[model samples]
Target: MVFKCPFTMDCAGSVTSSCLVAEPLRSTGGREMLRVHFTAEDLTRIRIRAHPHPLWEVLLSLHLLQTRRGAAIFGPWRRDVRAALHPSGDILTTLAPPKGYSPDFLTPFVDSPELDDGLEVVLSTSSATLRADMTRLAEQTKLPSWAWRIAGGDAEMMRRLADRIRQYHAQALLPYAHVFKSHIREDWARRAEMAMTHGLEHVLSTLHPSIRWRAPVLEVDYPVDQDLSLDGRGLVLVPSFFCWQTSMTFADPALRPVLVYPVDPVIGWASHASATPDARSLEALLGRTRATVLRVIAEKPYLNTKQLARATGTTPSGASQHAAVLRDAGLVNTQRRNNSVVHSLSKRGAMLLDKPALQDRAGYPDIRLSNPSAG
Candidate 1:
């Protein structure tokens, strides 16, 4: 289908009907859209976020895992994240709603960022602010037993809460947080280049499946049906690795407008899982047992946990445990099919399997045609 660039705005040159970003159309159903009306000032003020928000990603990831909405994509980190949250009790998990009111203080929009910076914002919130946030959250659903203590301005509890935030980040996010931000930068660079070359029209039209550029209005695919008028505040389009859904904005509509959208396929591919090593690399780096496991996976692609275990002479759980390590290193890629999850070599894994051959192929011959003196 052809997308027409709205003529009212200046795009210098026209855009082809083709999509510039690949993940948008695939990510959404295009059933319902957020019809966001833009004021003239909103146009100039509109921005694309250059990096992923550290706290937001953690909150979002925790939300998904608890609800199991996007659990398949998370891999073994599902278990690890829960363990990380254990120190905090059930309170941390309750803050990130799949939708509706979350305690704003806990997951505040980072007008300023950095995990500690945002946590400080949460911790430093006035008594009134904390009470208000807790009250709002309580109305939404049942909060945990200790919720009142934090809301009541218990300093010791708040200190412990901050530490919990640190622990949570370490477990769920530290492994891949920088990579997530880096991928966002990489994607934003492409969008920035496109906007520079083709103008903002191209940026909006192909922004995502859920978002559309229709002349004066910026359409977003939201859960509930409503129209949001930008009212000259403009929008911050934040690209996130952990934001698996269509897009979201700050709860406080009065706050500066922002839209948290998932990054494109490149970011998704980069952020989802890393590659696992092959037999040869394992032998050199780890041990012969690891090498043997790699060889078993290499011999057969898409081996389910049981098959992999049987082949490697280990239990299914053991095979999965090893595969998790390999997956993190950027060697193996795993997918779920029906009741089973299948694991196989990634491109990096393939290279690991045949690195010497690749090196030989890449080697260019320096042909020593007879040097006259030498001859």
Candidate 2:
């Protein structure tokens, strides 16, 4: 049965056409669920993007920028981006609203992990596809006259759209690209370790707090009720730094199957890196040796005491002592895992690293906008 356009938040919107089944598989406590059917072949074919997908990041980050959600985790980045981004770009805001459907043509699939390549895919969207996506977008969102022109296959309009997207990235995302990469990589390391040790099932089962794996079906908490059957085609798992609260997938089923979920906000090493403390300032607050240990853990998490000692140029006993102090103070979490005590930043630890005082005193430089691989 056809339904009204779905609620939008975190990229979950209406399922138009073949993507939605006649009836939604399940709903609980007024929450919609997206059930992805997988096969053994799909499991083997599952791919974790090595880096963040540049276009997906652009789209998802736009949603966060347009809203006040995740203030604790994303507030600093949002503030920085708002200061840099041009206020005149209504086109981006129109394409990516704070809620509801965003066109699939905005983020086309690209094999190469580069922003330029993905933008090219967006530019080359077939006219029929462009019109169809825009038409569908209009059902949920009021599109402008210029948008309809682009829907009519106006090449100049399409180029303009692509240019604006690129400019938005350079202004909003480029400066903090390192933070995005580092956080996503932390997640990648965790997932990779899980797949190697506990297996892929474990990875899927724990992707997000809202996602669950039940044999062949991966259920996700969504704003709309829908079910996508992958058939023989496997799913691509895209871990997003800006995707907050829940998970999202494409509205169109015919497109390649991919699931985008939020990376854990609490264990964000990149957030700490961006807002690092000044050497002397940290030393004053935490003492020299203890300061060094905190910095080491922020840069490289999940390190054992021996590894931490080697990295910090301290003896194992000294490293243990420092870690114990941090743990006692609720700045770090030390737990025995895989037969060794591993250390990671606690939520309080991450919050302390994110303090405005540290960032201001540190004299953090502008993150150089360099061309890097995307996830």
Winning model by TM-score: 2
**What tens digits encode model 2's per-residue C-alpha lDDT throughout 114-202?**
67678778888899999988897787667889999889989999877776775576556654555777678788877777766667677
lDDT of 1 by residue, 104-144 (tens): 56656665445666777777878987886677667757777
Off by over 4 Å in 2: 1-30, 266-375
lDDT of 1 at 230: 84
Which pairs, if any, clash in model 1? 24-209, 34-220, 274-330, 275-330, 275-331, 276-326, 276-330, 276-331, 276-332
Model 1, position 46: C-alpha lDDT score: 71
lDDT of 1: 0.59
CA lDDT of each candidate?
0.59, 0.70
Model 1 CA deviation exceeding 4 Å by range: 1-32, 79-86, 111-113, 264-375
